[model samples]
Target chain A: MRLRNGPAASVRYEGILRICAIGLAVFSLLSWLLLGANRGWTKTTRTRWQKDPVTEIEGPLIEKAFLPGVDLLAVGLSGALILFVVSLLVTKNKTNSNQVNSSS
Target chain B: MKNKFVAALGFIALAATAFAAPLEFDFKDPKGVNNVIFKTDAPLESINGTATGISGNVTFDPDNPGAVKGKIVVQSASLHLGNPMQKEHLHSDKWLDVTRYPEITFEVESAKNVKTEGNVTTADVGGKMSLHGATKPITVPVKMTFLKDKLKARTGKEGDLLVIRANFKIRRSDFRINPGQMEDKVSDDIELNLSIAGAAPRG
Candidate 1:
């Protein structure tokens, strides 16, 4: 049997790509927010600033720092962009193929 | 008159001897509260890390602040960034080379412009700092507070506490750290802030 290569197949591919793009974007946002939405680079450790009452010195002590930072956002956004671009290419290829078939 | 002058001179000599005696402060804090923060800010990227593996001894005379002498050493491998990958890179051969040079040290040779107010003594400490593989003479402005018999409050031990604070800047290239490369990502100037409390327990 021949594989489907028309409007139906194109629509299916577009739907899958759109879903993947949305999923990646959502994942990135959720992960970034969960990881404290750090504006700087990704950090594996988090710190809590504390002051020693006796010495009166303030410093950061490591808290639960195993959290990702803006790097997660970058990765997720980049993945979404690639998927969106692929979807556009798929639509263009389907239109071209249909045009060629009709001309024959 | 001569006997009176000789007795006065002897009293002055005794007072000077008492002032010259230094208290040795051991900086190997078991509480893990001591830390040195190192920061690099470049046009493209800024990095911050902390080193907690600090140990050394400093001979500080509160009565004679200008005669201070000591060595402070930080473990190279103890330097850590928030990012694990970046931390690994920092400890790698191309960066700090932690395996080759395990200790970053600053040995104090002299102090200048020493000033004392209350329990705090501030001075420009001249020291030879050995980092990466090169040793450079650097002068760091240090403020030290000698808390007499206050170690019990922090560690539940009867001792004296010496709180030291210093802020200094160093050129990474001077220490041969990736000289002339990745300047956009890693700044050549490394800003360091050291805050440590040394305990000298009395018998």
Candidate 2:
């Protein structure tokens, strides 16, 4: 092609996929950690049990953006991770198939 | 003399039965409400909000105010401040961190120095209260209405209704709500007052 100093085209595509996977991993982890407890609250002192209903507390942006219904978000992240792994497997399978074909 | 002793024993047994009878009810009345009010520094106005999702019970004897005991639990996530930004900070990690802790509970283990005047009775209700994350034992001065006739008329039922109110101050630092400079804007000593509308069958 007419590329000046850029890396090979296939290498660029692989790099993009790697970056995407890393980003999704971070997003998924942060969302899971931030979800914390879905509901319920208790106030306690040094000596007693104070069990009560779940009162609405102000949640942070991380919580507001990713929690409560975060199970869906987690599922989406897992799907993306699975796709990444699948792609890797397909690439490996194709390489093996090509090697066998060449040998034949 | 033997007859007199038997009569004395019968009277003592009757008193024990009266003293042991328990009055119990839930805070499930739709019309019932719980509210908490707190004041900030001079520049900031005091804040008040309605407490929802409240459910608890009280069990005690009118014949003996000192034997009264119960516990109530309030959900932390239900705290609502009309303003958006203020609510955010108040529940953040620096303040309440409601995400970390979801409920605030208070249990009455005992009562002491019980005294009554007219329909209003006062007692040193000793209990363990848990807020934020720390649990502490404190003796709260409680005032309650102990009149069966008045409560019976109000509830439109023959059951007993008791109205209890307790006021106390707690140090925020003790629970790690906000420490250091944050304490300046919001006082370390946060005032908490609880007024409970509880009821049960007459003993």
TM-score of chain A, every prediction, order shown: 0.81, 0.43
TM-score of 2: 0.56
Worst 10 residues of 1 chain B by lDDT: B15-24
TM-score of 1: 0.89
lDDT tens readout by residue for model 1, B68-110: 8999999999898888889889999999999999999999999
TM-score of chain B of each: 0.91, 0.79
Among all windows of ten consecutive residues in candidate 2 chain A, which has the lowest summed lDDT?
Answer: A40-49
Worst 10 residues of 2 chain B by lDDT: B41-50
Model 2: per-residue Cα lDDT over B84-168, one tens digit each: 4556777787677788887777899998888878767898888887879989888888888764644455455566667677777
Clashing pairs in 1: A44-A65, A45-A65, A46-A65
lDDT by residue for model 2 (A21-55), tens: 77877776665557542221211111111322211
Name the top TM-score candidate. 1
